[model samples]
Structure formats: structure tokens, C-alpha cells
Target: MSETINTPRQETVTAGISEAKLLGSLKHLFASSFSVLGELMQNARRARASGVTFDFDPDQKTLTVCDDGTGIADFQNLVVLAQSGWDDETMLTENPFGMGLFSVLFACEEVTFRSRGRRLRVSIDAVVEKRAIAVDVDESAPVQGTRIEMRNLAPNLLPAKHEVPSAGIVGLARYEMVEELRAYAQGFAIPVRLNGEDLPRPFAQENIPGEKTDIGFVSVYGIHRAPDRQVVMVNAHAYNVYFLQGLPINGSAVRNGTPCVIVHLDNASFIPKMPDRAHLYDQERAFKRISTSLTELVERYLVDRKAKLTPKEFASRHWTECKVFRRLDLMNDVPWIPASLFFRIGAILESSERMMDRCTALATTAQGDPEAHLLSREDVEQGKFRIWRNTPYAPSASRAAALLLKVMQREEVLALADNLPEGHWLNLCTPDCEGFTFDVHASGCAGKADYHAGDWMSKVTIQLASQAEIVINDPDQRMTPLRCIVEDDWLLLPAGFTERKAFNADLPFGDHEAVCLVIGRGIRWDHPVDALSSYTDENDEYRDDWQENSARLWNALVSGLRGDSIADLVATALNTCTEVVASECHLPHMAVVRTTLAEPGTRVRNAPRMEVVCLQDDAFWESFAASFDSAGDTALKQRLRDAFVATVRPGEIIRTAE
Candidate 1:
């Protein structure tokens, strides 16, 4: 028996805990005290807690977090570094790093954990000193889920609440703490309470009616108002917001007119970074995966609802989202250039009825014409034709064209023909329009080879007269009877023109150019002004001499229409006035004056009239004096000078007409 007792126990070697490293990590572990609440709440959630309750005692400087969940069974596992006490499923789903409890310890001076008829109180200094902390065990203690009381919490760790306990639970009255709790608890899985009052889940998917996916629940919030109509976001938008484990980790909902996407993630996906857990691990990769999945879900949703929605309704509701996701397939029968696009560009599209009529008329006019490309929906998709219009995202003509061609496959651009809406539809034009080198020939003149001269022969020049402006290939082109007419609902071709191999070689020498003039009535150049101002071919790839030649062509067209010189028009319209002066003409400074007009004592209100007077130099005065001498109105000239001297001050204008 002595020999058996004397037998030495086998010595086993295993990794030892490093007290020094654990102490050192305490300082760098949590970036903020707010993380203390998050970590403890997460633990409670992991324990399958139904709710979490908070209580604070100002006199004792203590915060108590109690959760009704599975009580802790092992005390040793709680303090052991890197040893998470969670089950394998919780470990895989939540990826708890066992560093969460340390965050609480880091934020508090003394933390007391009570559960399973046992209580352990540990001070931060005692842990640092490596002193033995005592755990009290008693069978008589009530058995329940975990309750943690953190004493002497770090300064400003949680916003202060009322001193008097209301109904035995302290209420977090300060807005800072209330908002902080709301931010974390709004989308939390379990219910949360303060002072026994149930906190509202304002942004939960159930309240907003979102769709459930494998990874998360998704919804769109906010309105996308158009210039002409308000488009409420009933579908989706790409303003991404990523919520992981009930907390938003990346991005936020932009409350402006654009729609915002809300994704409340499932617990099994997107693990948060350890320690602070402020953001996700591999955030970029997670974002990509989540966004991709969301896009797929949105695509499915749009497709399912497309049959029930009209093209206009669908485009209005989901145009921005469709562009963001490149999911333009849902716009099967929508117009090629929707009015919503114009609204985004700060331009208003003409009436839809009028637009449709124009398209129908153009289609009817182009019937049986060999050169006319009776564009089909398939043609628009295949990039055989492109609609060029400026949008907020696609501001340049080239970018708009490329984006249109890229997104609008198997979809018809319905603005021009095939009963599209009323707006200026853009298309690749003939050689004459592309060149910008052709001279404006007289309306009745025959086609000539050397027609590049700047000289004008006709005193009565041709101007666009009809609302149906049509530009054809040549006089022989049967699309229109006139030699040159702009397509009524379509804009002139963009400035730069590079010959594509796909075009026919037999087109007129300057076929795409605006060579001949066929003016019907006084020109309604408003469409041209809006179209050209919005759409510019100042692209680097198109042409190097575009500015010079384009301006020449534009001026020539304008001169023909208005019968005025370009220099005179520019000087009178632009050089003659300051922007402030011009703006003041419409929005003038006016003052009301009560005067005695009929009788000395009668104070009658007089109608106000405003006039802008220009201050003059000595040269102007001398000229005016000479004019007065010639016209024999010297008294009027002297009166004007006296009025300026007595009433006017530099940089100041009197509002009254007098």
C-alpha cells in the first residue's frame, strides 16, 4: 500500500496562460466604453435570452445588466482568455472570440457576475496584481439566468439617469443614453426594456414590410421625388445599409429624396471583428457578397411585379435602382428615354401624349423611306441606335450614350418612334450633320459640290417654321418633303461625327450636316436650346476640331433663323449686362410708398414702378451735354445731374420709383 501511494503522478505539458499579455491587451482591446453594453448584450443574446433589462444606481455608481437566459455552468471558462464557453453552433454562427467579457472588465473598475447559485466579484486592479479573487457559492441563492453588476463604471461610460429608482428599475432619461440604446436595440432579435417600459422597434423589418432572404431581411426606405411626380420607393434602391447582428456596421440610410436599402443580417453570416466589434471582418468582401445577394433578390422582386406594372409606373418607381443594379430588363415596354431621366437632369419632358404623337408622326413620315432606320426595340438593345440625353449620373453626351447602350438591351427606347413618349430622341445622324462643315445653302438652290463658303445670298433666309422639324439625308430623301427639317420630337445629332463602317457609303457628301434650310413658321428654338445645352459632344474621343466647327454651324443656323449677325447677338445678349442687373430685371428691389397725391393731409398708397439707372463717367456726361445742346433739352440734363447728386449713393439703389 505504501509502494502504490509513493508512485509518482505523470507530469503533462500544455500551454500555460500568459498573465502579462492578458494585462497588456486590456488597454488596447476596446476603443470605447459603449462597447461594454454591446458585448454583454451579445452574450445574453447568445444564451437565447428573451429580453435584457438595465438598471443603474447613481449613488453607488453601478450598472446592472440582467438577462433571462441559460445560466452559466462553468466559472473557469468565463475568465480563461481565448476560451469561448459557447456551443459549437454559437461559435460557428457568431464566432465569439471570448474577448467580449474582457471589454466589460476593461470599462468597469469592479465587475460582479452572479448566476447558478454562485457569485464572483473581481476588481481590475486585483486582476492586474494577479491576486486570487474569491468566488462565493451558496445552495440557498435563487437560481436563474446571468446578472452582472458593474461597480464604479468608467467616467461617462453610460449617460446619467434619474437618481430615484422608478418601480425598482432605473430609467435612462437622458437623450444620449436613450438614443444609444435605441440605435442598438431597434433591430435587435430580443426585446429590450428600460424601467420596465418596452422599447419600440421602429426600424424592424416586420413594421416596414420587408422581404426575407437567406442572409437577411431587406427593405427600401425614403422617397424619390421627380420634378414632375413624386415616386415613392415601393421597390428598392442601392443606397446600401448593412446591419450585422442587429447593429448597423457599415453605411447609413440617406434620408434625402433617394431611396435607401436596409439589410438586417441573419446571425449565421457576416462575423464582426473581435474585441470592439465596431465593424465586420473583411468588410469589403462582406459588403460585396451582401450587395450582390440583395441585387439578386431585388431582380427577382422586380421581375415578379413587372407584369402588373405599366412601363411608366415601373420606370418612375424603380428607374434609379434599375440603373444602379443594371437590371433594365424589367423595363421591357418602357420608353427608351423616360421622363424621369429628364427630371433628374433638371429638365422637364414634354407631355407624354404629345411625345407619343410625335413619335407616331415621325414613324408615319419615315414610312417607305429607304434611308430611314425604322428603329425597333431590338435595334436599340443591339447598339444599332443610341439615345443621348444628359442625366445626373451621365452628364456628358458620350457617357449618356454609352450608359444607354450598355443598360438598354432587349428594351425599346420609345421616345422617337414606335409610340414612345414626347421628348427629343437622339440618333446617329447622316454625314452632313456629322461633318459640321457644310454651308447653309438657299432653300431652292440645287446641290453643289463646293458649298463651304460663308457668304449668304438670300436676303430672306429660310427658318424652321413647322412644329414638326425634320432633318433628312438630302432633298431626294422621302422622309420629309422639305430639304432640311428637324425631327419634331428629336434633337439635332450630337456635334462630333466619326464614320462607322456599318453606315452606307452612298449617303450624300454632307448627308448628316444641316446643309439646306426649310423654315416653315417662326422658329420655336426653345427645344433646340434645351437639347443642345443639356447634351454636349465635347468628348475627347469624338473630334479635336469640334468646338470651332460646331460653333460655326450653330451660329450659321441661328443667324439664318433670326436674320441677325452672331457678333451683334452676342454683344447685345451677353456683353451688355451684368448677371445681377439681368436677374434684377425680373426680381427687382421694390418699396411701397404712402403719399399725399390728391390732398395735403391724405396719405394715399401709390402703385410702385421700378427703373434701373446707370451711373455714368465724364465722357457719358459730355456726350449727354452735347445731345442736350443739340436737342435744346438743357433743363432736363441739369435736372438729371441734380437728382443723381442729391438722391443716389454709390453701390446703393433707392427702391422707390421717385
Candidate 2:
């Protein structure tokens, strides 16, 4: 019984498995499978194979990629293919990354692999239940290189049928693949068959049409290896009409989708990575220098030889086409070169002579045009019409005038009173009085003809007068020796109290001439006195009296002073007065003073400390007080006043101080 119970010692093995890790690896596998062609091509390059084959069955939805590369050596490597961390250092002969093979499993349900040196064949199947499963390998018989046959292809994972058509599957007759492969193999060439057809060669030995026979040297800015990395310049015609190779890494034509000036190192390694996209314009600068130099050389050589050159000839002679440009229509997408430099070069070649002639003609015309001098003077004096220094005229007015002239097809003329001499004199004529008086001579029209009798003229004038009793009794309107005066051919009113009277005095006496007169209504001569008296009486203890006075001033600005026609001056005074008060008093008192200047309907409530102040029967003052409580500080109250004045309503009593 004791002899029957014998048992061997057991060994326990622990393996670490992470769900997140597995999911991530699976996602990478799926994404990598979509780019399987790149991987296989990489492997083919390492194997020194001329081309790689892609087999697809649309009906069955299957893709089989086979490369004539030095495949797996034995059953051991084949079994561990799905396993992570497979040693692939020795396979560095071509493919840099060994993970590409696993990416295939993501696209297909089953994968069969046969190596050249090995006699054993292995198959890998991805199990829906178990992450991945593989069959036991028979090392007794293995194939030479690697042959990967994948089945149950996910249609979505495959490249478009048109991108890698079945027709291109024939042997190495395709030139695109041949050119791509040539860069990898150096001088060695191999044939690739796709769908049983050979690929064709992409380029021939014929010289590019219209290329200049004589060699031309173009100076290029070299790379500056100090401070920061950047492209200096590239010689455009240096490698005219040459072909270049590119690696399809990460599914991009340029490195990281960046445009770069491809530079060939003396050691034969073309820098694969390009400058950042933000710095792509730097390449254009180099292109410009090269293109200019090359074009100059070509133009000099081809002088008097235009009749012998064709369109194609001209392109090849002056412009250089890079290999990247030929392989892909990248020039169309690259905004810097093809659109900028290439177009610039072409334009120069086509119009250089004509452009010079045009420039010469322009210079001569500038010296001959008499109106040019007048126009320049008008430009300098256009703003002189402003009433005050630094006053800005409406930009829209100028724009409208320019548009009108353009639409009417009239010669552009500056807005000058003297441009029409006859009209200028007529404008100065007194309509009601037969006598003619000139106030100011039109400086612009001094050299022109003078007004004569028996000439029919249309004249219009406007004069504004202050109707306020104070302004009427001020002696200027009544006792002035001269009511109107003419100086330098311009009519001026010496005693006009308001803009309306001044404007009306020159109006056509009998006939309406679109005249406008604004009678100064509520303007006052003693505004300061009235202001001080209003706050001095019962409201003197309110402490907001200054605010009320300030508000009145502000109202005077916006509403126009009762006895004055100049609203602009009143506004200026209000703004200046506020600053004066602010500089002289404490902030709270300043706030109270400023609030007084607010227009009617403007409100200023007391701060939190004064919220207990009850509202009176006057809704205006009550509303004003309410606003103060809501207003956090005096600055806020002033801002509220400014905002209210912008939209003040007529007849609304705005209480400035509460």
C-alpha cells in the first residue's frame, strides 16, 4: 500500500496578468494592423528584397502578405511570436521594430507563418474567450524565410482597394514600389509580384525636358548649428529635376507631417525628421534665395533665346523640381514653396521685362500730372476743416465719397472748397443783400478766377442765434457794431450768440436752402452761481450737494447749456470739472459731487451705512437713493450715471443726489 502512494514534488508557477494592459495592447495591435503594409515593406527593405507582395481576396475578405525576407529560424521563435518581449535584435538586418508581426494577428483570426531557414510551420489563432492561442510547433520541418498567410480579414482593417489595387500585384513592374525599394537596397534590386503581375519602374534615365545644359551654381544658406535649429536656405537649381526617396513612417510623407528641406548628409543619410510645422516658413526663405539666383543665371544665359524655348523648356531651365515634388504632388499642398516661391519665380520669368517698362511709365506719369500736386495738397489740408485740433472726422464719410466716385467713374477729387472756383465765389455771395462780402479767401483757389457781376449763382447760408434772455441782453447780439463780416472771402458772424444764428445769417433770405438753426433754449450765463446757490440752501447738509452740482454740470453737457449753443464745450467743462473735484476731495465726497452732474433720471444711492435714509414722495429721488444702495461705491455710482445719461428720457426728473 505504501509503494502505491508514491508521488513527485509539484512546482508552482505564478504569471502576472493585467486587464488594462491586455486591453491597451489589443488596441495597439488593431491600429498597427491597419498599417501592416508599412511593416511588411520595412521587413522587405531589411531583407534587401526588391519589392513586397500584398494578396487580397475581396469575396472572402482575406489579406495575405508574403515577403521574401530571411524569416524565423526555428520552431522556438515561431512559438514565441505571440508572446511579449520576443528577442529581435538579430533581425535588425532590415526591420527596426519586431512588434509589426503581432499587429497582423489583430486583423486576422488565423495566421500561418513559414520561415525560410526553419523546416517547421506554425499557426496562431486568436481565441475570443482566451486572449490568444497557438498550436504546438513541429520543429522537424520548417521553411526557409518567412511566409505569413493571414485569413478571416477584417474588411475595415484593410486599406482601400484602389490604394493597393489588385492590378498592382503583378511582379516588379510598378515603378512607384521600385523607386521606394531602391532607396533601401542601395544598388541591389529585387522583383515583387502582386496578384501575379510585376511592378514597373517609376523613373527613366532621360534628362528632364528643357533642362539647361550648362551647369549653374546657386548660393544657399547653410544650417546654423548655434542657439536654435533652423533651415537657412536650399539651393533650388542645385539638384534640378532630381528624384528623392521617402520612408512612410507613421503614415506621413514628411516627419510628423512637418515640411522640411530634405538635406543629404555626406555619409548618405538624409535627415528623416523635419523642422516643426510652425517653422515651415523658414524653408521658403531658402527656396526664395535659390530660386532667385537660379532664375537670374538662367535668364542671363537665355537672353535673346526666348523664341527657341518652349513652356516645358522654360520650367526646367529656371526652376528645380525636387524628388519629393515628383513622387508626391506635395507642392500643391505645401503653401510656402509651390504657391509662394515657385509662383514668384514663374511670374518673374514671364513678366520681368514688361514690369520694368511699367515702372518707368509710372515714374514719368507721376511727374507730368498737374492734378497730382493739387491732390497732394488737398490730402495735407483735408483735416484742417476740423473745429478743434485733433478732431477726428467720420471715416465712413471718406469711404462713402470714395465709393461714390468709383461707382460714378469720376476722377478722384479731394474735398476742397476751391476745387470749383465759380462755386466757391457763389458760396460766399450774400443772397438777400445785393452787396457781396468775402470773409476768408479760399487759400486753395487763390490763383483761380474772381467772381464777376451778371453771373447767376446759387448760395446757401445758415445762422444760429441764442433765444435765451441772458444771451440776448449780453450786448454782443444787439450792440455789436457789425452783425456780420466778410473776411478772406468767407462770411463770418461777429455777434451770433448761438450756432443757429450764425448759420442762419448767411441763409438765402427768401428761398429755403436746407438751412438749420438751433436756438439756444435753457442756457444760462450764471451757471456756476446758480449751481452753488442750489446746493447751498436746504440741501447743504446732505453732503451730496457737490454730487448734485456735478450731475447738473454733466446734464448741461449732454443736454446743451440753457443759454449756450455749444454742447461740446459744456461736455468738456463737465469732464474737466469732475477731474478737478476728484483731485481735491476725499473719494466718498468726490463720488457725491460727481453724482450731482448726472443727467435727469440719473440716481445715486447712499452706501450701506446710509441705507436707513427713507425715500420721500418724489419717486425720482427715491429711485436715485435705491440705486445708491445697489451701487457698491462712488465709482460705481458715477459709472451708473454715465450709463444712464447715454439713454436718458425727456421729462424724467433724474435726482443726482440723495
Candidate 3:
């Protein structure tokens, strides 16, 4: 019985490189999981499905994309799901590249498919580990249409936790999938469900019936082919050339079984890389016949609608290319084609009225929330009020004080003191009241006090004159200096005594030079003591000597200028010495006198001139004169001495009986 042995040997080959890297490169793949649903709906449309259903299982993390279309006849077709450039050619009316399924693969790990009479399932991990294209099939599945179930969704890809509606519901409240589905397929109905409930359609503003425009077309060329010419195939022949308006035509002989021209365009722009259409003729003579028919139809439409054809439409209808095909180039020749062509196409494919209703409902639902309205007047006002309270206080006070103190500080009448001196007092007296006498030597003389009497009194007169001068000179009359009287022998007025008598001791005498005062009404009395003290300390000896020699010098300077006009004489002396006049000294006339004295051509002419009326009874002058030798400039000094001696009025010489 060793007759014959039948042996069948199996051959194995390594699979090509895995597409794991390509699959991992996508961004927002799992994030926009609904876009995957849109892709599946597009696949269903290509299969000639009038209705596509999306079913979700929340607990199992699975989504089933089922379509009522001619199912795949063999399970081996499932291996081509994510592959590109497979059945996508000039012959296919829909997308030919199969990458859309890969977008689903990115979102899920396990994918199960049932088509034709077979069932197949694939796992992402298995593909990566095996580095090969693998397919397994079950021949007993009863599904008559294409059904794809994706499982093991990444946790991040899961829909937000929410209550799902029952299967009867169909609207935007379910998911955004239905809107996308309707957008791509014109008359196709898509039922999308989450956890077994169908989603509603999305709102669209442009879908109203009267809102859309009518579709138009133009035919460019004709096709002529002999009927029933069924001779054995010749080498090859270029057949009838036909053109269509707004439709792309592929015309190329097969080189290595690939098309030469592919046209792709969005609403405004054209896609690069026109596909090759050379393979369209080699498939079968039936395909060539189909191509000729489509080309003839396009030409007939162009000829019928030539009046409506724009430059772009005309070019698209008649132009023929040898190497490349461009949709935009064709469109550019047609200028009359409106941009709403795509939308018009969509409206015709779907029922415009239903789409409009769905859009309205969605818009209404989005607008129902109260927070959507812009802020009101009350809200704005309240927000502004809150901000106003948070501002700092020091900056505000500084701004206010800047305005109030501007003029006073500018005129030099009032100065800013760092710190008030010990025992210094400020007396803001009532205007026009006086006879207020206060003794300078009285205990607590440095303390503040207010004294009042009748109007038009002596002290009141003094105070009024001083205040008036201060007000006139000060740019900003912020504060009026206090008025007070000083002792006759006081050399310097104490700090804070703004309106004080100069007294005889304030003038320098003997071999001393007097410093001159500048004539100005507003003089700052409140020179900060610390700053003045620093200056004084730098010239300690000079200040000490001025104080010590005060009494003698005071008597000499004030003797001739006494009584009612002593204030004027004091002011004149200050001006001539270039000393700073106090703001409280109100004798304006003294300013004129000092100006005359300081003039270049004027001698001391107005000075008191004494004439010895009768040669002065004895030789008192002759003997006093004979004791001095007339030498050097002592003559001027001698003359001054003589004039001073003669001018002294002989009073009762009431000395405190020494």
C-alpha cells in the first residue's frame, strides 16, 4: 500500500515594516474621538449606504460603526483598512486611500469587523509585537452589511460622565457626530448614539429652503465612439475626448498601473499632489466605457449651461493637460461660479428644511444660559467702585498738597521746616484787632498766646501792615507769619518771630561791614533750623562776635533813625547791607531809599549834614582836630568822626548815675 505520498509544503515570508510609527505620530487623534465617527460615516457613504448608525457601549469602552451597504465579500479586505492608495483611483467616487480607519485605530486598541460572509478582528498590540499585517476570520457570522466595532478605548478618550438618552432620541443633545455626518454626505441619513441613544442633528444657519441658490452647469465638449465595435483589443488607442464644467477628467495611459491626474479642492484652495490616473484604463474595458460615459456627461452639461459658465467654469470644461491637472486653475478661468457651490451641493444632498430646524434648536439651547449676556450698567459701576477703594492714601494726599502748596513754596515767603523748634509757637490772630501787648522778657515768652483789643490800635496797625505785605509777595499765601514785638537791644530775632522789630543791636558797628539785604516783599522766615545751624556752626567765631558786640552797635545805628520811622530805617539798613529782609517788615518806602543810596553816582548826599553855626564858641573842634596827624585815608575817618560828634543832640545826659 506504499503507492503514493501526497505532501503540501507551506512557505513563509517576513512582513514589511510595521506602520506603528506612522500611527503614533497623530496629534488630537483620541482627543477628537467624534472626528473618528465622522470618518466612519464617510466610509459608509462610499459603500453606497443610505443610512449609517453609530452605537456606543460605555461600560465596555466600545463603539460600533454599522452601515446598510454592500458588505465586503471577503475578510482579507480588512487587512487593507488602514492602508493608503488601495481602491482609491479615478474609478472610485469616494476616498480611495484607506487611512481613515487608522484614525480609529489610534483611538482604540482592538478593532473587530464583519463584512460579506466573514468576521475579522485585529489588536493594536498584536500588530506592534508581530510587526506584520495579520487577519483572522470567522465564516459563520450572519452580518449582511459592514459593521466595525472598536474596543479598549484609552481612558483619556472616554466621553465625559453623563446620563445617556434612550435609543429613540435623535438630535444634537446626543453628540456632535450627526452634524459632521450630514455635512459630508448629501442625502445620507446618519444615526449616531451614545450608550444606545441616538444623537440629534446639529444646528445650521444656512440650511433654510429659500436661503439657498439654484445649481447650474455648463458642458464643454462632445465624445464620439463607434457603437458595438468589439474587435480583438488593439495595442491601445486614445478615444473620444470630452470636457465637463466644474468636474475633473483624468486622461492618461497606464504606465505602471497608477492614475496620472487627481483633482482635490476645499471651499477656497486646491490640494497639492494631483493623483496619477494612468491605471484607470487598464482595469477593464468596462472601466474605459464608464470613463467615456462620465466624460460625455460632463461635456453635455457644459454645452447646455454655457451662458452660466464663468471663465473658471469654461476653462475647467474645455482645457486639457498633458502632465498635471489643477482644479483651481480651471476654477480661475470661470469667474461667474459663486463660492456657495459646496454648500448648495450639500443642501441638495440633505433636506435643507430639516437641517435648518436642527441648527435653530442648537443655537437656542446654547443661548439659554443667563451668563451669556454682556455686563450691564450696574455691574460695571459696582466693579469700578470696588477698585476705587483699593487705591493708596499717601499718593492722593501728596497730589492734593501739591496743588495747595505750589504758590507759597514758589514765592520764597514760606519755607518748609523739617521740625519745629522747642518752645516755638504759631499764633493765628484775628485780623484788624490789636493793642495786644506782650512783654518780651516775661516768663514763658516763647509760648503761644492770643491777645485782642479794639480795632485801629497800634499793634493791630503793625500786624495789618505786615500781613498785607506777606500776602502781596507770596505766590501762594498759605500761611501768614505771626506778628510780635522784640526788645530794643536784641541783636537777632528768635526763630518763629516773623514780624519783629530789628532793634539797635541787630546792626554791626566799629570796624565791621554790614551785609546787605535784597529788596523783596516775601521773605521766608521759616528757614529750617537744622539747616541754618549747620551753616552757623561752619562760621562759629563770626556769629559769636556779632552777638557779643550787639549792644554798642545797636545804639550807634538807631540813634538818628528813631520814633515812628524806625521800621523804615531798619529796612533801609537791611537793603543797603544786602541782608535778607523778613516777610513781616512792611516799609516799602525804605526800598526806594536804599536804591538811591546804592546808585553809582550818588554820594552820601542825603545823609544828615551838620553846620557849626558860629564856629562853636571855643576851639573844642580846633583842639580835637590838632591831636590827629593828617596822613593816609585817616582824613575820611576823621571827617566821619567829626560829623558824628557834632550831630549828637545834647540831651539831659540822664545817665543811670554811674
Candidate 4:
């Protein structure tokens, strides 16, 4: 049983206000006129206003705000403006600062208020001069609510327009923002119109496109560290925040640094707000709270949610939420969140109907190389998976494909090897030789990271369990022993990883089971990943003849490693000959393999796959068997010797002359 500790009750303290001081603060308080205008509109809404209108007569250089609501009660007492703090003793929860009316009085040259049968006008000169505010009683054509107008708005104050304009205060309107506003209106049970157009709802199950498409209203309180549709996510960024009337005041792109045009909405009210009412103050406090406070809550919520929804229903609901950008901070911050979630995220990115359509369209216009199969049978049937070899988004497309492969959940994903690193990109390539083949391509260079193939295998099992072939691309320059063992349809490739390699490769790759071991250069390809792009060499030329010959040597090396005879390893020593001849001619695989043969940045296991070379200690074999007991590498030395012997051809001779 857990003991409960009691602490003394504390009262919430608010800062005392001063009228003159606050009036001077408006210069920084409202960066754009929209913020000030938004506050005034919110004030109207708080008073249960049925309608609000902003009219600007440029000819008269005056702006007028009209609202159908309870009228302002006091204008004579300046102390009324000084008592600006929100009063929460009642059920009321609207304006946090009740000084919006005074903020206007201090900002404008002259202010006029007409309501019921009374008219009050106040001039800043009169207030500063300590004169009585002018008031008049008029019974003719009495108005029930309030009408406040001002002449000569402060600089940058909004000049009211009839319709939402493209350049002025309304320019800030975005599709997401409009949507957020619509949702807020429904939640608060109010109707809001921007320049006469009804704010269409965002964040709703259904959407109706409006006459204006740019209004994006979002008051995104929080993002899910793990996105599950069954339970609601408690947003920490919303910890101390709410947007003013739930409108997105700050501009943020949908994915933060990504290319997606939408936004990741944040709250200014939930967090500490800057004096300018611009953005969250103390943003780090919010982020840290997300880590420490909400992790347990989020996990509990997920557990409860999973219990309620079927797998397909859960997946389908989650898929709809893929349009929102995944939060960047929470990925590393929360420990309970499993990396397997990224795989699901990747699926959402790649499997989107719009993206698939784009790929298909690109594939139609471009002819695929004869040796390479660009589209799979399933791809064609589904009208998706087009290979646009020349589009500007090829690199991004590859990332999407990589993400899709990363999160793939299926029974057909078979393990190829043990003790390899995380972050090796795998794809279900439809090569000419097979229906759909599994091919692995490792990105980023492995410097000095641990390799645990078994751990990765567990994750792979959870994500993709396969009954198909897996081909590992064993790059050449590594010092670590890369040996492949045939297990059913698995083509395993051992890698050259060590304890102290130069550390440059840095993007989070690795789960608890396996950390990424990077090698080779981290080359960034910009265009759509073509077969040729994957095989770029010194002169950057791609040729079929060279690829065919390299493939022959590659197949021979695999064959040699599997053979029981040491002679097979010895025979394949000419594999180095294939590499040399290939590299001298700028063969792409040769250039890649050379990284293995070259002097490593750090010392390593140094086992040479006569298939790919690195200097090995002569005594390495003596202790090699003891190094990997659980990894099942007892036969590795025999395999390496056999593969080396297999490198030499029938015409080759080795003789000692005495």
C-alpha cells in the first residue's frame, strides 16, 4: 500500500495591475492587430454576443466594433480597468485579463461607446489631463447591446475590413487555424464568422470545404508520444496553455521542420505567455513536464484503449490521424514509448493514397530500366507504388519507403542474420528473378556501435515475420567480419563493426535489441532512388555489363562461404581480382567494397570475406570461435577459409620455389 502525504492548501496568486502601466505595455502585448482584435471579439463572445462586426471606413480613418451582448457597465472609474485579473470565484472562464477595453482606450486617440440609451466618449488627452469622461443620455432609437468605435487606431492596430483580406490582420488565417476555430465554436457553443464566412470545423470526423480554403485554425494542446486512437492523449504543451479563444497565434509548420504545409498547433495559454501574448514563455518547462508527468498516464491510457478496440479498428483509426505531424521531442524524451511505433508512422507516410497516386503517375511517364522491375504486381493492382526515378522528391520518397519498411507488420519478414546493427533499410524489391524479394541497404556510416542481431530479430519478428528470401548488401571496406549463413530463405551478411570507429553517423537508429553500426559514407541522394543511383561510382556512370559481372562474383562469394571445403575459400581469393578489375574500371560495387579493404579508421575483428577484404590478424582465428558463443559462429572460421580458397580459378597456381 502506498502512503499519501498531505500538504497545506495553497491559494492561487495573481499579479496586481496598474492602468497606466498596462496601457504602455500594449506596444509589446500585441505584435499584430489580429491579437488585439481577437481579444475584443472574445470579449464579445464572453458576454454571450450573438453577432460581432468590425467596420472600417477608410474615408473617415475610423474603425468601429459592434457587438450584440450585455453592455459595458462602467467607463467613469479608471480603477475598474486596473482590476484586470480574471475572477474565478464564479463559473466564468473567458478573458484572463479584463483590460481589453482599456487596452483599446489607451491605444486609440478617441473612444466612443453607445449602448442602451446612454453614450460615453473618452479621449486619451482628457484621461491624461484628469478630466471627466464625456457622457450623454439619448432615449431615441435605443440600442440593447454595445457599440464601441475608435478613431485613429494605434500603429499596427487592425483597420477593419468587410471580408478576410490577404495582406492585413486576416492574412494570418490558415486552414488549420480556421478548423480549430470552428471546433472551438462548437465546443463553446458559439457561432463565429470571419468577414462573414462561417468558420468551417477542423479536427472533426467529417470536413466541409469552405469558400475560402486558407483558414487553418488549430489550438493543438498536445501531441501523442505514442499515437493510439482508442484513448485521448493528454497534451503537456497545453499544460498551462490555451490559445486566445483557441486560435493559433504563432505560426508553426505541420511537421515543424518537414515539408508538410500544415501545422503542429501549440497553446499560448497552457504555458507561460510572453508579455506580448506572442508565444509560450519557458518552453523547456513544458517539454520537461511532458517527459516526467505524462509518461505513466500515457501508457495507462494506451493499455485501456487497446483493451477496447479490435486490431483492425485500432489501425484504421490511427491511420486517419497520420495527417498530423508526429511530435519530434517526445520520441527521445519518453522511455516507455516503444520504437516500434515509428514503424507504424512510416506506414502512414508511405501508404497514403495521395502519395501512392503521385508515385504511380510518375512511373507511367518514365520507362523503367530493362533489368530493374520498378513496380510490383500488388502495386499495379492497387494503382500505387510508381517509381519516379527523376522526380525531385526521390530522396524523400526513399525515406518514406524506408519508414514503411521499418514499421512493416507482417508474417513474411524473415531474419537474414544475427548481430547486425539497427537502421539497415530493407525493401520488398520485385527483382526479375523472383516475385517479390527482400533486399537490404544500410545507410549512414557505422563508426563504433554495438551489434546485436538477436535483439533486432525480436523486433523484426514483432514487426515482420517472413517466409521469403532476405539479401544483405555486404559493403566492402569494413574491418568487421561479415559472414552470411543460409537459414532457409535467409541470406545473412556479417558486418565489420568495432569498439572505436570514428563517430560521425548520428540519427537515432537502434532499439533495445540492436544499435545501429554504421560504415561507409552517408551519401544523400536527392532524386528518386533509381537502380543506378544506388550504384553510383567514381565517374557516376551505371552500366549493365559491369553490374552483371559483379553479381556473378557476388553469387560466387556466397557459394564459396557456404561450401565445406577450404579449397572453395582458397579458390575464391580471386574475388579480390574481381574487385580490383572492377574498381579499376569504376564498377560501383567495387568502389563500395574498397571501403572494406582499405585501412580502417579503427582496429576491428579483421575477418576478410575473400568476398570483401580487410587486413586480418593471423591469430584472429585462434580466438574467433570463443568470441561469439551465443551468436552461433563456431563454423564461421571454416566458412571464411573455404570462401578464401574458392576465390582462385582453375588456371591459378600457388607454388613455393626453394
What's the lDDT for candidate 2?
A: 0.32
RMSD each, Å: 16.8, 25.6, 34.1, 20.9
Better of 3 and 4 by lDDT: 4
TM-score of 2: 0.30
| lDDT tens digits, residue span 1-658, model 1 | 3554576899999997679776766768677567777677778888898888877655577778888788788876767767879898888787778878877777778888888899888866776677777779956433878889898877767555544434343344542455566567666678777656777665555555576787678764432112123322333334555567766564342333323566787767778876667777887787677767866775665675556666545655565556555665455455433432211112221222322232322231244432232334444456554333221122122312211221221123222222222321322221112111121122322211111322111111223433322222322221222223333222222223222211122222222232223234323222322222222243523332533443344444544344455445544434423352435443322222222224235566443222223444545555666776777466777776666556644435459876
Q: For residues 424-453, could you state the per-residue lDDT of candidate 4 as single tens digits?
A: 111222111111222444332212322222
User: By TM-score, is 2 or 3 better?
Assistant: 2
Best by lDDT: 1
- At residue 630, give the lDDT of candidate 3: 47
lDDT of 1 at 124: 67
lDDT of 2 by residue, 1-658 (tens): 3567668899899997774456346534343334454445545645545466666565566656566565554434333334322235423312233345555556566676655533332233333243443334446323434566777775555334234334433423233433333332221124444555553322211211122222221221211122112222233333232221213221223212212222211112111122111112243454364355444443443332224544333233222322212211211222111111101101000122331222211111244433222111122234211111110111111112111111111111112111111322212221211121212111121111111111011121222333211111112221112122112111112222232232113322222222112233322221211111223335434334554554454344334322233444434565756545433323222111111233345466422111122222234444664677764455655565556545543234458976
| lDDT sort, best first | 1, 4, 3, 2
lDDT of 1: 0.50
How many backbone clashes can be found in candidate 4? Answer: 62
Q: Which ten residues in a row have the lowest lDDT in candidate 1?
A: 430-439
> How much is 286 displaced in model 4, in angstroms?
4.1
1-658 per-residue lDDT for model 3 (tens digits): 5889778898899968455664444434334454465557656655666557776564677777887776766544444544443344422433344555656666688888877656667765554444554344557543566888888875655644345654433433344343433333321234434435544322111111111111112111122122111211111224321111111223321223211111111211111121221123234553454445444443443454445644444433333320012122333223222111111001100122322232211111135432222222243233311101111111012111111122222332111111212221111111111111111222212211111111111110011011122111111232233223222111111222333222112222122211111112212431111111111234442343432233223322333323225445554545545345445333211111212223236553554422222333234444445555444345655685567545653232456866
Candidates' TM-scores?
Answer: 0.54, 0.30, 0.28, 0.40
**TM-score between model 4 and native:** 0.40
- Candidate 1 Cα misplacement greater than 4 A, ranges: 1-18, 58-60, 138-142, 158-175, 204-208, 220-240, 251-259, 307-321, 333-439, 443-471, 474-658
Task: Quote the positional error of residue 106 for candidate 3 in Å.
Answer: 2.2
Give the winner by TM-score.
Answer: 1
